[model samples]
Target: MTQTLALVGAAGGAGTTRLAVEIGATLTRTGRDVAVVDAAYETQGLADYVDTIEADVTELVTDGAPLDSVVQPAALETPGQLSLCPARAPFERLARAKTAGAAETLEKQIAAIALSHDVVIVDTPPVATNQAVAAVDMADRIVAVTPDSERGADALARLSGRVRDVGESIDAVVANFADGTPQVADADTRVPATETTAPSQCPSCLDDETAFAPAVAAAVEAALDTTVELDFETSGRLDGLLR
Candidate 1:
């Protein structure tokens, strides 16, 4: 069965999309059919990251566009390749993307995409959005990405509760742009917290050598209690360092 994983940003600039791209890239290197879906209709960063604006998830859900028609391959296709379904419309159209039955519509669409891909990594908007609620609802696994700050911690706490109220739980929480400072919360021991490397200045820059992908893959493996082979250098065109 295809694994549907959603990476949600607990706070703004949490590097959620970047992590999704890296994880998708890593999975592709392991020979898994991976498709990263941008559910964050407002930002639409995944389209630019993959260098393709051909079609987006908006088309899939609103226009009833076929999966193949919406999914476009990443710019660099080597060592296995990652596909992306981005948002075609701008932020204002997000309301239109939210279907009448909201969660149900998005879930069905996401499930259809899952049928064709081995792994579907969803990059969701902030926790407050309806798109995020649907993404979390449809995902087989949920990974929260946040900065190592009080704001991120508080946002995560609320987001976790929101999902739990809907009968779901966060599988793991990744602390992006972490500086090893003591701002993370220990409210729950069951939920695992991990850290990812971030540049001193630009936290959004994508770096293949960073521990981001490995950390996320590790968190997923630990949460799911299964090993997922991830090679780190997939983006650099270098041989993958298996973990």
Candidate 2:
């Protein structure tokens, strides 16, 4: 069965979307079929970072579109492919979809996408939003991303408590753009910051060649309680990165 991993930003600028893309790309390089979903409706940042179809996640909740129709191949050209189910609609429109049975419908669409792929990486918006909460509820494991600052750490604690309150376990916590070491006792595993400069094209998407990618993939693997493999190209590949 496919596993869903939700990469959530505990606060703004935590590099959740970037980490999601990097992890998805790394998993692909390791020969896994991966699908990245943009659940960040307000920013639609994932769509900007990757090649996407005209449709968004909201379309999957409506009557006219099929899940595959909205799914597009990400630009990552690894031996294994990376696909994306992008969200491009305005926030108000997406908010409406969150009501009634539409959210459940959206969850079903996401579940179907998971069934077809080896792993599904959900790039969520900052924690505490309804969209983020819904994604967390659907996820098998949550990888909460935060910055190295005290505010970031505090925000992560709040988000972690909220997730646990709902009976979901946070598999890992990644501190992005860390200038120095950041510690937290709540995380099962903590990934140190690797990238300092931002990418020119997408603020969140990191180049696969960067050391950041491998470090994150290894950390996420460790969070999943699997043997950590530091190699990005060869040995540390998980059958399902989120599993």
Candidate 3:
């Protein structure tokens, strides 16, 4: 069975996108065909790490376009063997892509992609938007990305309620931008927290140690008990090291 995983943020700067890339890359390294779908149209930096082709999923929904035509292969600097569907250009394309019959259209496209791959990893936008909500509805497993800060925890609380309302469950909570230690409340019991080094310099601390791909691989192994095989050029390089 193909696994469809959605990585969402408890709030912005949760490192959800980074986690998605790691998971996709690891899966691909293991000789599994993996596709990374970027749903966060606004900021699409995730496409840069891998070979990315522009896919207008919204266009597929609105115009009944072919899903294959809409998907573009991302460009990976190194050969990691992963495919990517970049978020639409101009961002608004996603909102416009949601046609009256968009739900079914999007699902069909995703199903087709799933058939061609062992795993599909979706990097979703922040939880409040309808697009983000739609992605969650389509996911087999949802992973929430949070931080160790108090505000981050609060955001997770609110996001958790939203997930419950949608009748979905979060498979894990990745503590992005973690410092010495992360403090998660007892009430948030859906998933345990995984921590990595915090990103530095970047405004969102997006490039911190938490952004490391291997750390994410470890988290996935812990969460799913799925062994991963990676091609490592070096211990720390995120790009060459594929599972």
The prediction achieving the highest lDDT against the true structure is 2
Candidate 3 stretches with Cα past 4 Å from truth are 45-55, 74-80, 98-100, 185-213, 222-225, 229-243
lDDT of 1 by residue, 23-133 (tens): 676566667778888888778777666444655787677667777878887644546667888776855556678655644666787788788888888898765667788
lDDT of each: 0.67, 0.68, 0.61
- The per-candidate count of clashes, in order, stands at 1, 1, 17
Please give the lDDT score for candidate 3: 0.61
- Tell me which of candidates 1 and 3 scores higher on TM-score: 1
Worst 10-residue lDDT window, candidate 1: 197-206
Task: Tell me the tens digit of each residue's lDDT in model 3 across 157-182.
Answer: 88889988878877776665543444
Q: Is candidate 1 or 2 superior in lDDT?
A: 2
Per-residue lDDT value at 140 in model 2: 83
Q: Which portions of model 2 miss their true places by more than 4 Å?
A: 183-210, 227-243
Which regions of candidate 1 deviate over 4 angstroms? 77-79, 186-213, 219-225, 230-243
Model 2, range 1-243, lDDT digits (tens) per residue? 787888888877777777777677767766778888887777777776545467777777755487778888766556677887777776677777566467577677778888778888888875566667778888888888887678888988888888887678678776655545444434444444543445334322234454455566665574344553344443333222222
Model 1 residue 172 CA deviation (Å) reads 1.0
TM-score of candidate 3 relative to the true fold: 0.73
